[model samples]
Target chain A: MIIGALGPEGSYSEKAVQIWILRHRLDSVGIQYFADIEDAFLAVIQKKSDLSIVPIENSIEGSVGVTLDLLHENGVEIVGEIVVKIEHCLLSKGGPEKIKVILSHPQGLAQCRHFLKKYFPEAELRSTGSTSHAARLAGEFEEMAAIASPEAAECYRLKVLLPNIQDRKQNYTRFIALRAAGKNTAEQVFEQVLCDTEEKTNRPENSSHSAFKTSIIVYLEKDRPGALYEILGAFAKNKINLTRIESRPSKKELGDYHFYIDFEGHISDAIIKETLKDIKTKTDTLKILGSYPAFKA
Target chain B: MIIGALGPEGSYSEKAVQIWILRHRLDSVGIQYFADIEDAFLAVIQKKSDLSIVPIENSIEGSVGVTLDLLHENGVEIVGEIVVKIEHCLLSKGGPEKIKVILSHPQGLAQCRHFLKKYFPEAELRSTGSTSHAARLAGEFEEMAAIASPEAAECYRLKVLLPNIQDRKQNYTRFIALRAAGKNTAEQVFEQVLCDTEEKTNRPENSSHSAFKTSIIVYLEKDRPGALYEILGAFAKNKINLTRIESRPSKKELGDYHFYIDFEGHISDAIIKETLKDIKTKTDTLKILGSYPAFKA
Candidate 1:
């Protein structure tokens, strides 16, 4: 089996796929790297990989707009969700004091902000394309340090100058494994790779845990008063729980937005269908991104 | 009079303040450049700048999360709003054939995505801290080009190789002028700088345009089903229109978010006051982020 992710081999996206592979016990998968999330997502559409893993959002960095936008644009389904805790390490060739420059991806730079300011206040900060790339650069420079995962640091053979320096230790990023809309990637994973996750399916046949989440993209016909309120009222009257809600520009006009909303329960449920039907009447468009088992934060 | 904005002299934030100053007819204002939004926001708190212009959102880039976060953290009031159209220019010392590298801020690179792919696909794209900084670098390097504002290109004396290359021509960014809360800077501006803004004020004595907008920060007591729906219901029932709604993490933990919502109507209205009273009951905490007249998009 093959999987697609963002990389030059040591990226956090690569790390996320590694974690997902390990969790599913799919140890024999090949990893293909892409330049960006859209490229990785495109790999799935192009059938280069059976599935692709890309970050949807970070707890600290907010939503990964590219991923959200790609999912909105393409006919892809989020089959699986994984939350990876982001741990930033200070890596260098020598001691921390020897570092005069700190390099990292913007998020990496932001996550370890407090630790960097207190220890490397005088160091020049540079935002690189990826933490692994920063690690590779830091490994070649004697006066440079990197803020990245220990995995990326090890890949570049750099010493860990400091471990877990993220401002808030609970910082995590949510990644979604996406595949072509019609493919049942989740069924394949549960039946062949991992049976425990099967405990999570809300297929009505699954006997174990049954927590499912449905994601929807909503577009109202007009910017009228109570337009969004009426839409929310549909879900509220039905007692559905919303996990997340965000507005993104429709890219059509200045004030137009498509609300990306996630809520509890599978789309197959009667109430969920009723909610969508009502929302359709009130909206210009409604897209069901997918329904997948909910993952713990 | 003095104004604060994010800058090193040629930044877009500086351009925003300049436009605000020009529109308000406050020609004698001194512009103080700050390292970041917090520094500029802090300037207002410290009474260093009577007003600070900071970006709130962009048409394509979405929300400026840092500015949103700082506004949430500080006791700041948004006194005025401005929308700046982003026009990206291809700048270089030599012609397009001589350029092998492209430099710009991430947003600048993203805005002109199509133009770069078509014209400079072979150029190595480097993300700089700001478009002005990119212009400065492009000016010094004969083999590099930059995507930045025309003003910044002129500042560095770089040639405009191409103009208005953004993927979308209607791209704009919204900036808000902030001051310390409880101090109606608009009232003072009307008395001293700009009287028209005062006429638009919600103050009971004001006899001009009454259209107003109110922004609020809401933190739900718990992640209960329909908590947000109930809050939205309050406004919907009152016929208030929401201009924007975005959720940012509270920085305390994952899954905890503070919803920053902007809606039409003045807080001084009895209906607006009643809506807040209802929201207060449904929320763990509520903060009024202050309001100014709605700016045309």
Candidate 2:
């Protein structure tokens, strides 16, 4: 089995895959690294990988728009979710006093703005493709430091100058495991993982009763005053709790948008099905991304 | 008057400021440049600049999360808006054949990804602080090309190797003009601009009935099925049209969110005021971020 993920190896997406592997006790999984989230998602669609793990949202940074956009554009189903705690560390070859430049992914740098502003105001900040990429580049320059995970510091053989340097301490990232639509390999793996989880937690075998999340995208036909309100009313009337709601531009114009909503229910549930049926009547287009067991942590 | 904006002088934020100045026919406007959006926003709050202009949303890229977060965090109000059409150009000191590195802001690079992939697949892509910064760097190196505005190419003395190189042609960016709350100078200027607009368009002088947009931030008191729906219901019940609705993380946990909403009608309208009063009762906190005339273009 091959899992596609954003890489060069030490990314948080890889961490999510490790957790998924450990929970399922899977040992034969091969990891394929893609430079960007879209490529990783496309790998699953193209049948090069059985599943793909990509970051969907960060607690501090908000939603990954590209990932959300891809979910709307592609024919993929989310089979599982993983929540990884983000702890950004400042890594360097030498001490902080010698640093002339700071490097990281734009998000890593943005999350630690206060720390950088106060500690190394003179250092030039540079953006790399990924946090791990920043760590690798930091390894070659004694006067450079990187804001990345501790795992990245170890992988690049750099000293941890500062741990948990992000402005907020409650930083976490939610990643989704995606598979090509209509593919059963990932579905079987997800069921096995859920079975293991149920056994460990001593929960019931009925999958419908478990905590599941269903995601869908909706586009309104007209720019009416209450169009979105009426569409959301279906979920409200069904008493379904929404975990997330975000609007992405439809690309037709500035004001036009497509909403991506996540609610706490399985698509197979009778009430969920009925609610979706009602929502479909109110919306011009509605696409169900998937229904998956909610992450416990 | 002094305006704070993101710059090395040729950023899109600067272009927005130029358009605003042209529309208002202001002659004594001076621009103060900041390295990041937060700093530019802070400049207004600190009274270093009379007003600050920052990109709020893009047609293709969606909302600027940091700017929205700042609106929620700071005591600034949106007094005006400007929309700038984006036309990315490939610039270089030498011809395209000599280009080995393509540099631009991350958004610029992402916007022109398809163009670069088909034309210069082997060239290294680098991210700079701004597109103008990339143009300036390209001016110093023959092997470097930049994706920036045509104005940037002229400013940096670089040849425009290709124009309109972005993947999407209908790209537009919405920039908000912000001023410190309780400061009447910006409000007075806004009224002057509105009067000028009414004169040019041959419209009536009733400010309350004009095309206006009001922005607000809402935080639900509890995680319930109908919490957001109820808040949005207030607007729907009043027949107010929402232009945009986006959720940003509250930075407390993964699922916790604060919704930023933009809707038609000014805060001064009787119906709008009543609706907000009703919404305030439904949510834990509701902050009014001011009402401004909607961008016409």
Best by TM-score: 2
List candidate 2 stretches off by more than 4 Å.
Answer: A183-205, A208-210, B116-125, B183-205, B208-210
Best by lDDT: 2
lDDT of 1 by residue, B1-297 (tens): 889887666778888887887777886789988755657778988999988988788777687777877877778788778888888889999988899888886667766766876787667666565678788888898998988888888788989989898877888888898888655532232232222233333454552323677788998855687888889999898888888888887777656788999888766555776778788789998878775777764
Query: TM-score per candidate, in order?
Result: 0.89, 0.91
Chain A TM-scores in order: 0.85, 0.89
Across residues A115-229, which tens digit of lDDT does each residue of candidate 2 receive?
Answer: 9888987787776667887898899999999999999988999999989999899899899999898834322323434344322222225875348888889999656779889
Where in model 1 is the C-alpha error above 4 Å? Answer: A94-101, A113-126, A183-204, A207-210, B97-101, B113-127, B182-210
The alpha-carbon deviation from the true structure for residue B236 of candidate 1, after best TM-score superposition, in angstroms, is 0.8
Provide DockQ values for all models, in the order shown: 0.51, 0.63
lDDT against the true structure, each candidate: 0.77, 0.82
Clashing pairs in 2: none
TM-score of candidate 1 against the unseen true structure: 0.89
lDDT of 1 at B207: 26
Query: Residue A167 error for model 2, in Å?
Result: 1.4
